[model samples]
Target: MDKDISEITDKWKNMNQTHIDTDEKIGPYLDKYFMKYKKTIYDSALSLFYALDTRNLRKSHKHEPISIQALKCFKDFVDRNQATIEEAFLEQKVILPACQFAIYRESETWISTICKYYHVESLPKADRIRLLQKTVNEKKFSSAAWFAIYAKVIREFNLQDIYVPLICQTRISVVEQLMKQDPAIAQDVVACMDKYIDNAGELASFARDIPGANFCLLNDKGIAKFAKRLAREYKVPIQICPRIDYNAKMNAIKFLFRRRYEQRKPMDKRTWETMIDSVFDLDSPASEDNNLVLELIYDLTNYQQYEEARRLAHLHRIPENKWPKLLLSNRSSPDRPLSRLGSGKIISDRNPKLVSVEPEKYSVDLPDDKIFYINSHEKFKEMNSYITKHPLLAIDTEWKPKLGLLNECNPKAALVQIACQDRIFVVDAVELCRDSEWATFVNAIINNPNLIKLGFSIHNDLRAISELIADMNIETKPESFIDYAQFHKSLVQAFKIPLPDYPASSGGLSKLAYTVLGKYLVKDDQYTNWAMRPLTTDKIIYAATDAYVLLEIHEKLESWCQERAINYEVLMKALLKKDSTKNKVNIK
Candidate 1:
């Protein structure tokens, strides 16, 4: 006990007085003292008691158990230093073991002493509920614990009117523990529990009435039935939720075909045959997926059955505009495995084999207007004047892809893409990078807080721009930027959407293009060297389309949120929360 006391005193002496106000140091000090002394064998007839106050201390050994004596000491200390104890509690200095002392002694006054420091209305919802849980479940002080929980419920109700569901749905053990000593509250508790469960089921049914609520996992059978009925009546496509069994997938497929056939829009024969074969082809040396829509289309194309493949597209109602990219491209490639070096980063020996593409056939739907090429100072100045007036612009940049993770080559900015409502300006960063007008134009868009700059995965783009600005010796600050990829993730987690997990760092631009525009964006030129001079017509269209489409996608997202009654400001707050340990942005 002397050594434990000395160690704790040393820890306190080592800590600066300023840091004593922080809760971080108190837990360790208490933990060491308790670990050493509480576990030591002591005389059964006498137990140690130590009391600490700002101005005095009391120490004794009595016939009572150590925990009981400790509780008495704590009460005396609290009586003398009520303000200090409350402040300590607010700092979280009073830990579970200390609470255990008061609970084991069954001292209502001590419990009240602790409760006065914590108020439900003063804390966040989660924190307040956690405090209540600790108080109730700390020990078998059933009467005092129940009173605290019941009071907390009333306080929470007064604050937000959100307490009924929480109190009613609290763990059954809590109710059982409270009711063992207080049978008078049993009837009221059980009624609240039943009401909470019934209300939950009704909420699930209401959610199912929304169009995209297929993303929600429905546990209630009646709600699932309601969703299925709505899907059938509205002729909506059946979306598969997670954990679906083989039989469930088969039934959904059958239901889809039956509805389509009744409407005289029966699926094509070849496509149906292909779908059946893929569903039951578990023995085949390929991936197991029930849909097989993409695999079947590719197989038909590989067999040179273009006529039948095109007919399948027609039957599926694939927009004539979207069919070519959906059915035309080859994506399967041998993975370019990476090798590691001394720096603990992955690097590849060689790049992946590039697939052949017809540059002449590459096209993107754009306005029937000429794209401005700002290679000279005068054109650069003119473009900047036109773009700075718009409150919103879709922005993007082009740079040569890094050869490897640890590739030592310093990347040079290739192009800067800025698109407004009617025009796109593709700046030649190689030529205009040193020009003052170009730097000024870039500064205006990035630094203006009121000007909304929209992009996909803007982190890398900002880094590249930073590098470019540094080389030009320009001081600029970027603000009011929106990365749609992060926005999509916020929406997904917030709405509990059942989309497949995408790579967390990527923009998922290809998926967004298909979802929002109802067409595919050609990505064959994605990783090509953008620094090459005399850019091909295909590359020019790809660059312009990449920037221009962000504006269109933003419009679609706004409408989607408005239709679903999602508050845009509230959704953005979720995306801005940073995980301190991982240094990653996360949905709060």
Candidate 2:
């Protein structure tokens, strides 16, 4: 054991270092060289990095100067190999630094790049889109043509579900062109506006960044049809006026509606009201605009109970009222032909057995769309369409009834209910008492010799109506206004029909209804306060029911006359000609 020390020492010696110890030798030498000339080496390495790595150099020397020669050389390299670099970018060069070296010179290049990027199959769709987003962030494009391309690409990539309003924002204007080229894109544009704007947001906010307003969206045949559809879909003030050939069919202006959020619940009454109000924007509607409001509402409430709602054959009757006795023809417009329905709607069409056995059933059985509360001029204007569409009207007046005989302060008819074939308008007598325009329109409509107006005990009502309409100084009553009371009397006498329980119109509209149609007007409330603002729902229902029932009563009485082989039109004319003082009727 003691003799092994020499062997161990020899073995250790034989395993000695044959190669140079590079780490040991070089450590101090490098330290001595770099320590002596450290600044020069550091500067040289940094300069090389600045020349080669323009990205990081740009970051570090953002406010400082770099080598101009290096920059020039790099620019020269990019310029000389521009095509090669872009081609490489095309061939799946996923490196973004190569992109920066290439396309960030200006935004038009970015726009061009985004359009070209759509076809670069080498890169994945997501990556191409990411690059597009980077470019988009650099500059937002305001070119309509570029927007149209996006409208195309959006469908191509099927990104429509993500950007609905933006799709509607961009695609609506260019839909006709896009449709002919790629029907999928045009239809998608239409589909993008599938949901009602529904108080999504205010118009000003939606138009926050109108991309290409300076450009005309479209001015062709498609635009009117497109604008009409948009009018059905519009909300913003920009949408209120789609100025084209107003007569060139109905067109809707493409308004950029920015969605606030996708509300996924039923709206409250107020919200629902606002939504309907916006869609039926009437005050600034186009001169030749379709009766879009009535048409749409008719559809919404087009139930079996109110089958008359579907009576608008073309939804094309509004502007036709400019001529009270406009000749019915197979063609109204030069290019597009129009026709009238063979059997026009009448009060009989609205007769749906609406009367209830239960006395407490208070509602008028009318959808909110069927009732127009015309408190403002806007609402009055909205009703003008219905007025034009259906000249035959049923009318009634509501006044704050004199509480006592000493009440010398004569209350004007607080409101007047005008019931046409399909809708009821409650005109605010108080609000419009001084509006000369309102008086003039009312005068013209009432005096339209061809119109057939129906009312019960209308003598006092016509006088009240004239007084309420301050300016026209209506010296005479409505020329064609027929008193339902006298008509019933004429029907009973001329046709020898059975006498009703209530013989006199003085018995009231309710008793008269009960006598004629078996559907008495429900007493809304015992205490009548008609002059109240925001008239109570019960009051509105009652008022509308009163006037609307006059038409119903007349329909039943006329049918009786027809059944009895009596000429109802001649009977009505005799009733209109006769005075209340002489309670006898003469149809000759």
Candidate 3:
């Protein structure tokens, strides 16, 4: 019997090698040769081999798609094991991925089998969307792989123009719970923002409704951005600004403007000057309240809404006895002082330094002792001790640009620059990726809520590399990542200033650095091949400047928050909650 089994196995091997073992051959081979020895180890081992081979087995005649071929193999495996399927999954486990792979290709058989498997009764519910929505049954709907797959189905199916409540509805129902455990999961959904635009409003609204920010991933800046975009799309002026600490040196006039902007009462912004003219007339209570009229002029002037300030001041007939000055002669800039009304208060005292510093003054000057470029595996091991002690870090990555047509593929990562205080560690990702402990090291800093990781448009830098994402297993885990780009938007929305230099929709790192730190980042090296050995001096500086400048930019923004009485750490820490009480209450 042993000799006979060896002979059958040899034929199986030969059949598999030549690609002659089609779905047709596998059945007979399993039935005729292996059927007689079902109880032996050969039956189990050989059965395992043949099941794997069957899954990949193609139909020789029809040239069916891989999805169909796998589905057929799965059906066969189930049919043959129907008697024992309820008791054991030894063979079922081998072919299950076939069903999963089938989700990619649209087929009747694929649809039918899923219905029977899940006991799904409705035909429409078992369709592509229902299955896409059914992914909520998994540990979480935010799986990066499923997010990609579902997005592909949505795009390929041309569901963009039509609003799909079911999509965001499914996500919204469970995200609070999912976020409680992993708030970073919101980052994944936000990462796929371009692919899921149809329901951006619903998603943003749902995010706002999540109540209490801890583990509420969707409520972050990305969704806030989408909310603002939707408002723009509908031709409405949105005031989706982050919470400002009113008690802490906040401008009362600015706060009132923000609150009123939320109501959108002055919908016709084109004619707002004509309308506000009447609201601040002498007969109106605004004129009687001296502080109200003066601050209104101050708020308008501060944001460079000078025409409105001029209109308000002259229209109200600023009496010399009232408080504050109105130097309307030179309302061209915030720097120009306002002349006094009756009460002797000057507007310049309340004016903050709201503009970027001179471009020439902005520089990233790191001493030789401060910069560490690690290119060797030995040097990579020493990285943790150097970086882990700091509670705040500014990180940026560099990679070889992809010259090929497949731009979707991630670039090969070369360097990961981490800046803290006076020290900057330019860790070579190529060498570190080879180390088994590399992912652990990365997660320690990025996922550590106690440690703040700053990046500009950060999700793209970390998520673009599939190889690194898999190595680090960070997709589902909550990343305590602070995307300054979104923060910049919050600042713009709150301040309502015309940022003429860059696109209003985005906060590019260079623009942020220039505006916040008065330093313009030289981005010529951005397109260069980063994987080259013997790193050039220009590459090192360019990389170091990107990471190092973030530290200063963050400090400037932090001061802005402090001046407004906003707690920067509290906002960041809110997103990093590892677990939430809400999860235990509603999660089933």
Better of 1 and 2 by TM-score: 1
**Superposing every Cα of model 1 onto the true structure, what RMSD results?**
22.2
Error of 2 at 564 (Å): 1.5
lDDT of 1 by residue, 410-443 (tens): 4566888888877888888878778888577757
> In order, what is each prediction's RMSD in angstroms?
22.2, 28.7, 21.6
lDDT comparing candidate 2 with the true structure: 0.47
User: Candidate 3: how large is its RMSD?
Assistant: 21.6
Which residue pairs in model 1 clash with each other?
none
**Lowest lDDT block of 10, candidate 3:** 240-249
Full-model lDDT for every candidate: 0.49, 0.47, 0.49
Clashing pairs in 3: 320-342, 321-342, 322-343, 324-341, 325-339, 325-340, 326-339, 327-338, 327-339
The residue-by-residue lDDT of candidate 2 on 363-475, one tens digit each, is 35568789888877767766765585676788888885432111123456778888986788888888887654565456556666667778877776776776676455654
For every model shown, what is its TM-score relative to the native structure?
A: 0.39, 0.37, 0.38
User: lDDT tens digits, residues 176-236, model 3?
Assistant: 3222333233333333443333334555564443323233334334444443333223222
